[model samples]
Target chain A: MIEFKNVSKVYPNGVKALNNINLFIDKGEFLVIIGLSGAGKSTLLRLINQLIPVSTGQVIVDGVRMDTASGKILRNMRRKIGMIFQSFNIVKRMSVLSNVLSGRVGYHPTWRNVLGIYPEDDKQIAYKALQRVDILEKVHNRASDLSGGQQQRVAIARALAQQPLIMLADEPVASLDPITTVQVMDFLKEICASDGITTVANLHHVDLAWKYATRVVGVRAGEIVYDQRPSQTTKNQFIKDMEIVYGRPIHHDEFVIEEAVV
Target chain B: MSDRIIVPPPKRLGQTLGILTVILVIVASAIFARFNIIEVILGLQRGGRILARMFPLPGWFGPLMETLQMAVTGTFWGALLAFPIAILSARNIVDVPWIRVPLRFFLNILRTIPAMVFAAMFVAIFGIGNFSGVIALVIFSFGLVAKLLFESIEAIDEGQVEALRSLGADTLTVIRYAVLPQILPQYISYTLYAFEINVRSAAVLGYVGAGGIGQLFERALAWRRFHEVGELVIVSFVVVLFLDFFSAKVRRSLI
Candidate 1:
């Protein structure tokens, strides 16, 4: 289990991004955090991986106190938790295979990875991950030559090749078209189900959250306001509950038209 | 749609004043330096008379070859040394201010010392020869290529670096994967650009007893052999022009 105990984060400029957040996530749960822009959803998700250092309180991950860990220990924890960004930050100058193989760098010696001496087994793993994401044919292609959707798939394959225990996606589909959005979301959902990986995603569209989330946690002004299963949530609740989060009622366009019937 | 934004014209007060000041300074400096157009015109006339004897450039093989050899050797080693210097100087790659600060300060100090000054120093240390010229050119190239390359590194897409970090990459691995690939082409182009410039600089390095075409030119001038000096100038000009063309083409392909 992942636990955040009275965790708080305040920026150097005194802007509080998270406040006294105590939460628990089970091993195989698919949790989606939804909030308005800068509503602390990203902060809360990042806290799990210790990407953003906690200003106060303790963050215990699988019984290790991550807040006090340093150097290699922290990096070891981070390697097991795969994170993807909105921009699909793949190195454009590299081939797709090299990009995926980069995910395995943490597993080897520093000098080995620096020299780009990937063992045959790692290459096999990278290939299998690419195949899983259905982008194996583009393995030799430069990342810059790929389409937006294809790039995200490549990002996903890179994360998968890490063999991470948990997956965190920060608005993975915000840049993608509607058709490709569904396709990428389906792949993530399928991966979470098959691997039983604890998945946490920050989603913008309300309908997308409702479709994918086993549990939805709403954050507003650095605090969790709504935490419930989708069966217990309604359209009116999405507005009334998120009004404090968004500083207004949720708009219509924020919901995808083709909402999945889960 | 109807409410069009009216853009105001740029206020040129500063620019106008700046141009006026520049012109005023130039005129004042020229006058202060005893500006004499008649003397300059007479000098140009004498230069033309000297230039008329330079047809069919002389066989400048000996000194010309020395200059080329010095530039090539200096540039090869200088370009090689610049890689590590650039990596250490780049702010994104080396976050420690102490390391980067000292490296940048040293590079600035090296660059501030002109190539002629370096050649003189090398001549003092190693005595008059092509070795001193090569040393001077090597120092010049190292400073220049490192400065340009680090700036390119700083301007690269930093998101790739962060991505490598997310993969638990070490500092060296991050540099190899993220920073190297993005900046390699630009670094190579800059090195070639430096080589093109080095050839021109090497020609004058012989002035300080650093050995090159300048030594031959110096000897020819000492003897008042205007025709021989003219021949040397023509040959040097042709070689520099050809190197510039070839390097320009190569740099274009690199970028």
Candidate 2:
């Protein structure tokens, strides 16, 4: 579980990315954050791990205060949190297995990692992670050689290899095609759900959010504007309520309706 | 539209002034250096006669081999030392401006001093031999390779590093997993490039008594053995050409 108390973030050039805010994410919940670009959605997700420091608040993740933690404590806290990016940020030149094994770096000493000596159990973990994402065949292939969707799957496997308690996805499928987007989102949701891992994903597609998220939160101008459970609201009502989040009527293109079946 | 004719645009005053400055500098420098077409034409015939006498190459594999050895050794040691320094100098890797700025300045100073000058200084300290030349080449290769490598490091995709950090990878682990893999090919390519340059400079470091075939070259010239000088030039040319071709092939394969 993660909690943000009176959290605010201002960039060095004085852009207030997040205003005085509060948010809490419970364990094993697939929470989707919906917002326009630059609406502090990313800032909020990153704050949970203290990737970006909070200006004036406490970020407590599973009990430890992330903003004040340093050195071994910070690293120990971070090891339990995995993050993925829209760009599929696996090392392109490295093999898929190596990229996945990078997830275990936090568990070992620097010299052991440098020499690439992972334990036999760690190797099994990496392989199982790859298998979970259905990318086991490409384990020996270079990461760059994979297609966009496969690359994203490899990134997911990398995160899973960490055996993380929480996974943060920043626009995880923003670069994938429609069908691939659904496939990737399905894998992410299914794996995290089965593992009882908390997942916070930033999604541009409203319909996808409706389909996957247990709870959906909307952000605007560095503030949370809407929060809902799709189970409690009708699909039509959810679409209608999103107008307050977008500051305008929801466009048909924002729904991702055509890709729903896939 | 078909009947319309476009006129040439007039040049801006600044452009005209820049061109004029270039021409002025060229003419002034040529005059100061006493540029004489007739004298150059006359000198060419003398140069041709000397070239003709220098034909029928002499055997001197020992010094040529020594020259190559110096380049190989120097480049190896220089690139070895450059790795850590380059990591420290990269802006993305080391965010502290105080550390990075001074490291950059030190590398700049290293590069500013020519290999020949470094050879001269080392020769003064260590005495004349291939040791001094190797030291010179080491310093030179370090500057060139480190500068090129750090720039490449700074330009790599930051997202990969971010991913590593989010997984709780320490700085060294991040570098080994994320930073090094992305930059390895370019780093090796740069080191090979430095080796190529070192070969040429190593052959000439003997002018400052730094050692290698350059000392032999100086001896040949001093003794008026033009044919041996010609032989050295031809051999050095062949070796340099082979290395350039081989290293280029290797570098291409890396990418």
Candidate 3:
């Protein structure tokens, strides 16, 4: 379980990225945080992993309080939380298998990892993760050689290789085409469902949130304005709630046309 | 649109001509002081006679081989030493300002001294041989290679580095997996570039009794054997050209 108690983030220049927000994410839940650009969706997701440290309040992950965690404890905490970035973040010059193998570095000694001497079991795990993403065929290819969608799949495989307790994705599909976006989202959804890993994703498209998220949380101006289960959400009510989050009425044209078709 | 608003072409042309006149005057003054066309014309006849004497080259193939050997050894050791220095100087890999700053300053100081001066100093201290020449080239190559490699390191995508860090990889692992792979080709290319420079510098290192074909040239000149000196110069040119061709081929394959 991930628990946020009065979490707030104030930047050095004094722009509040997140307000004193309290929330709880149950284990195995597929949660999607939605907002406009710069609405703190990314910040909230990053705070869970302590990627961007919280300026105030406590974030307790599993049993460790991240705000106070330091040195080895902090690293240990990060090892269990796998993060996926919008840009894929795979090292372009490295092979796909090596990029996936990197996710296991935390488990090995520093010298071992530096020499890239992962155990046979670790290699098997990496291969398994690639299989899960259906990108096993590209295992020996350089990350840059793959197309954007393939690279994103490789990124997913890398995260899965971590065997993380919690998966954090920050706008993972924002740069992908529509078909690839849906495919990537389905892969993420499947990973969460099958592995029972708690997944938190920051999404820009409202329809995608409704389609895949079990629970949806809305943020506006650094504050959570709405949080609800997808089944209980009415389309009109969701749009009405978005007014506070967006500071304006949600336009019909902004909704994904494919979601309407479905 | 108004007739009164029409600009005079002659006035604009005069302004341009005035600027051109000033530039021409400066060029003329610089050429007169530095080049002196009349003196160059007067000296050409004497140069022709010297050139006539330099024809029909004598073979000093043995000294030529010695020069090539010196350059190869110096560049080999210099490039080898540059590897660790370059890695330590990378900002992402070496976080401590105390270490990074001092190492960077040391590299800067190494580069600031010309290679010939380094050879001269080593000759004075170690008393003249290929050893001094090799040491000079090593220091020179280290400065060039490390500077280029560190700058390339700084320009790498920080995203990959962050990804490794998030995976809980230690500093060394991050460098190996994230930093090294991206910069390796560029590093090799830079080392080769440094090698090309070292070859030329090594040729001249023998001027200070650092031992190479340059010693032969110096000896021949002292004895007024311009023919032998001319042969050595021709041999040096051929060797340098051959090395340049090989270096270019290697660099082409690396990138």
Candidate 4:
């Protein structure tokens, strides 16, 4: 379980990126945080791994307070939490398999990893992760050579190799086209379900969040405005609640009518 | 779109002040040294007489070949030692402050000392041979190559390093697979650049009794054999130019 108790973040420049956030995410939950740009969705996701530290309160993951964790304890905590970036962040020069294998670095000693002397079992784990994402065939190909969608899948494979208990995706599909977006989102949802990993994703598209998310958390100006399950959410009420997050009424042009119709 | 805009040109106060300070210092130094343009003109007449004595060339292939050998040996040793030092000095590769800071400071100190001084120091220790020249060139090249390479390393796309870090690859693996391939071309270019510089510096190492073409020039001049000195100068100049051109071509291709 991941719990946020009055967790807040004030940047060095004094921008309040997160404001008194109190939330709990259970295992195997597909939670999507949605808001307009600068609403602290990314900041909130980063705080769970302490990629950005919180200014106040505590973030507890599996009963360990992240704010107080340091050195080895911090690294151990990070090992169990996988992060996916919108840019994929795969080393372009490395082969797809090597990129995936890198997710296993925290598990080995520094010297072994430095020498690329990963054990056979680690290689097996990497291959299995690639297989899970159905990109095992491109394992030997350079990451830059892959298509955008394929590269995103490779990134997912890398995250899976970590055997993470929690996965945090910061706008994972923002850079992808609509078709690829669904494909990537479906993969994320599937992995979350199959692996029983609690998944937190920051999404821009309201329809995409509604389709893939079991629960939606809306943020506005660094504050959580609404938190609701999809089953309990109505289209009109969702749009109405989104105003507090977007600071304006949901524009008709912004909605993908085909998805809403479906 | 402007509504009665009052635009003032950017102030030139800094540039004007800098130029004025430079002029003032130069004027003050010239006055203190009793500057005389007439003295320089008279010295040129004496230079004409010295130039007249260097007409006939002496045939000495042995000394010429020895100089070439010295330059080649010095350049090779210098470039060889620079490789690891350059890699260690790169900020992205060596994150430890204890290692990086000291290595950077040492490289700076090496660069601050002139190649001539290094040659003189080595000649004092090793005693009048190509060995001293080669050691000087090696140290000199290490300073030059390491500075260029570490700067190149610092400028590399850090995204690649971060990606490697995420994979859990050790620092060395990241450097070998990600960092090394990208910087290899530039590294070779820097080595060639260092070699070019070393060849020029090595020729003069013999002035301090470290063997090279400069030794032949020194011997001929001491004995008042202007013809032999002229021959050594011409040959060394041609060799330096040839090496410079060849290294430039190679660097152009590598980069």
Per TM-score, the best of the predicted structures is 2
Candidate 2 falls in which docking quality class? acceptable
- lDDT (0 to 1) per candidate: 0.86, 0.90, 0.84, 0.80
Residue-wise C-alpha lDDT for candidate 4, range A149-236, written one tens digit per residue: 8988998888898999998888988888877887888898898899899999999988777778889999988988989988787867
lDDT ranking from best candidate downward: 2, 1, 3, 4
On DockQ, who's better, 2 or 4? 2
Give the DockQ (2 decimals) of all models: 0.23, 0.29, 0.24, 0.12
Cα error of candidate 4 at position A261, Å = 9.1
Provide the lDDT at A3 for model 3: 97
lDDT of 3 by residue, B1-255 (tens): 122222123345788999999999998997887967678777997887888688743456665666667777877777778767777887766677888899999999999999899999999999989888888888888788888888889888887887777777767888888888888899889878887888788777778988777788788899999877777788788888988999999999989
TM-score of predicted chain A against the true chain A, for each candidate: 0.94, 0.97, 0.96, 0.96
**Which is the winner by lDDT between candidate 3 and candidate 4?**
3
Clashing pairs in 4: A102-B167, A102-B168, A103-B167, A105-B168
- Tens digits of per-residue lDDT, candidate 1, B192-246, equal 8888888999999999999889998888899999999999999999999999999
CAPRI quality level assigned to candidate 4 from its DockQ score? incorrect
- What part of the reference interface contacts, as a 0 to 1 fraction, does candidate 1 reproduce? 0.59
Docking class of 1: incorrect
Instruction: After superposing candidate 2 on the true structure, give the runs of residues whose Cα lies further than 4 Å from its correct spot.
Output: A259-262, B1-59
Number of the top candidate by DockQ?
A: 2
